[model samples]
Target: MDENESRISALTLGGAQERPMNEKLYMLTLSFSIEGFIRQVLTQKNWEKAYNKHDNSLRLTIKLDIKNNGRIIESIKLIRKAIFFWTRNPKIDHRIWIMIVKDDTPFYPLEEEEARQLLFDFNRDIEIKPEALKKGKNNIAVFVELSWGKHEFIEKNTLKKESNIQQIEKD
Candidate 1:
C-alpha cells in the first residue's frame, strides 16, 4: 500500500468544548478499514471474500478513555454491528459522527435522496496512487484533538498580517 492508503486504514479524531452544567463535550470521529482482519470462530480460518452486509457477521468495538494528570477520569466503550456496506457501493461516500454523551444512546439514520447530471472536464492526471485498474475515490484519514483548560499566556506573539504586495515579493 502507498502512504495515503496506509494512513486511511487507521486513524483517530477527538475534541472537547465547553457546555452547560459545567460539563465538557468531547467529539471523536474514528475511521478504519477491516479488509483483511477476519477469522472464523470455529475453524480459525481466514475469510476470503468480499464483505457482504447481508451474509457477513461482523462486530466492531470502540473504546475511548479520558485521562487527566496521569489518572483515568472517564471511559466509554461502544459496540456496534454493521448495517451499511460501503465497499459494495463505492459510488456513494459515507461518514458517521458519534456523539458521546453521559448516557449510552444510539442514533438512527435519516433518509433523503436526489439526483442530477453533470458535465465532465478532462484535466491533467497526477500520479498519486499505485498503477492499477481501480475505479473509485481515494480514502483520507485525519485525527483531531481538542482540549479545555486554563489558557496559556504567550509573551511575544509572532503572528503578523501581510499584504498582497509583500506576499508576491516573498514568492
Candidate 2:
C-alpha cells in the first residue's frame, strides 16, 4: 500500500477511535508605521516639551516582563529607536519598527490594563489568542499581534495549538 493508504489503514484497524489532541499554543504580533507613529506623538504639546528637553531626540525603548502572579516568566523588548524632529518644521524621518517573536521564546499574557499602561501615549495595536484569556487560569498559552498607525492602535488575540499528534498526522 502507498504511505497515505497505509497510515489510514493503521488508524482504522481495530476500531480504535482516535481523537485529536488539544495542545495549547499562543502567539503575538505587533506592527506600526515608524514615521507616522512618531509624528503623531510629537504633535502632542506635552510630548513636544518632553522631546525638546531631550535634545529633540525621542528615545523609544520599552521593556515588558510577562508575569504570572507577580512572577516573571518571560520578557519582551519592543522595537527601540531614537528619532529627532523639529517642532517648527514638520518632517518625518523614515524609520519603521517591525518585530516578530521567535518560536523558541516562551509566551506570556499581560492583562489588558497592564498592556495598555506599557504602551501608553503611543500608537500601537495588540492581538492575543482566546485560550490565553481564561480568568484565574495561569500557565495558559497566548499569542499577541500589534500594528500601529497615526492615531490608531489595534490589539487582537488569536489561539493556535501545536501538538505531537498533529505533527505525526501531517507526516
Candidate 3:
C-alpha cells in the first residue's frame, strides 16, 4: 500500500486509542434516504453504533408518533407492537423485538432502568427496514433499528437446504 493510504488506514484503525479524536462516527447523522435505510437493515449496519451512543443495554419507555394509515405493512404494525411490549415489559430482549407507537399519548411511564432497557434491546433486529405508506402522507413511516452480532451455530446453507427439503415433505 502507498504511504498515505496506509497512514490513513492506520490512523483510523490501528492504535485508535492513542490518536487524537478528529472524526467520530457517533456524531454523524443516520441516513434518511430510502435505499440506505433498506440496506442498513438488511445488510450494512450503522445503527448499532448509534444505539450504543444513545444508551446501550438500557430499557426504554418509548412513545413515538406512528403512521396512521391502515396498510398492514411490514414496519407499521410490527413497530407499534414492539414499542408497546417494550414499554410494558422492558425486561423483554430488545435485540429481538421492535416497538411502534403513535404520537398521541405521552404517558410512557417506567422505572428509569426499565426505560433504558427499552431503548437498548431495540437493536435485536439487525434488519430494521421501513416502507412508505401507500394511501397517503397520514401514514408516517417510522423505522426502529435493530442489533446484529455473531452468535449462530450450524451452517446457514445446510440449514436452508434442510428446511427446504422438510417443507417439501410436509407439503
C-alpha lDDT values of all predictions: 0.23, 0.29, 0.23
Let me know the TM-score candidate 1 reaches against the reference structure: 0.28
TM-score of 3: 0.16
Per-prediction TM-score, please? Answer: 0.28, 0.27, 0.16
Better of 2 and 3 by TM-score: 2
Order of models, best TM-score first: 1, 2, 3
RMSD of each: 21.6, 18.7, 22.5
- What RMSD value applies to candidate 3? 22.5
Best by lDDT: 2
Candidate 3 segments whose C-alpha is farther than 4 A from its true place: 1-33, 36-45, 55-97, 102-171
TM-score winner between candidates 1 and 2: 1
Worst 10 residues of 1 by lDDT: 113-122
- How does residue 100 of candidate 3 score in lDDT? 24
Model 3, 76: alpha-carbon shift in Å?
Answer: 17
Which candidate should be chosen as best, given TM-score against the real structure?
A: 1
Please estimate how well model 2 matches the true structure, expressed as its whole-model Cα lDDT. Answer: 0.29
| Model 3 poorest ten-residue lDDT run | 159-168
Residues 1-171 of candidate 2 have per-residue lDDT tens digits of 322110001111011122334643333322222222233333334334544465332333344443333444555556433333342322323222211122223212122232222332332222223343445444322122223322222112221221111101110
